[model samples]
Target: MSVNIDLEITVTGPLDAEQAERIADALNDVAQDEGIQHDISFVVDEWEGRIEVVGGTEYPLIITRFGQWQPTFESRVHGAVQAVALAAKADIKWGYPDDED
Candidate 1:
């Protein structure tokens, strides 16, 4: 049986092109280091010239799908995210997509 898992990481801030690229690179490195075969993508939302005040630190969202899931998958994912967050100086919110809906 093949186990597949989808992950979503939401970063709550404005992301520029460079920042997005950095995040993507970080995610790729994470996946590679963990021996996880994954397809990762990113989405950066535009606020439409409207400045909405967020009460806390903002981060970027990272979406990844794994070809196989293992028991320690979540921890591996978190570790990856943490490494990126620390390097980027950002906060992150993440979860499995299936758990959302």
Candidate 2:
């Protein structure tokens, strides 16, 4: 995609430790299926940029772009995040300042 995107994931409400773990697991599973290369286990400060996780203990499922931007890869990652949110039954949102949608 030619457009710039800021893809960051954050929990919507009060996310307890247990729920966070489930979200992590779900994200991992979906990421694996989507063939994501970067380590989304946590916030990779080395990425070009990162969005801060607001109020709570930072949750791990962050998907950061590593190299040349690939729209299909990012699209799959977004889809994976959506899948994780559905599986965990949690309210998760992805996208940042530059995102149009």
Candidate topping lDDT: 1
Candidate 1 ranges beyond 4 A from true positions: 1-4, 39-101
Candidate 1 Cα deviation (angstroms), residue 83: 7.0
Cα lDDT computed for each candidate against the true fold: 0.43, 0.40
For each candidate, what TM-score against the reference?
0.38, 0.37
Model 1 lDDT at residue 75: 58
Per-residue lDDT of 36-88 in model 2, one digit per residue for the tens? 42534422121224222221112333335634444665455445444534432
Q: Give per-residue CA lDDT, model 1, range 1-101, as digits (tens).
A: 32234334444344455555555566555556654424444444336652211111132223334323443555554455455444333333334444556
Worst 10 residues of 1 by lDDT: 51-60
Cα-based RMSD of candidate 1: 8.7
Instruction: Give the TM-score comparing model 2 with the true structure, all chains together.
Output: 0.37
Point out where model 2 deviates above 4 Å: 1-6, 37-39, 42-101
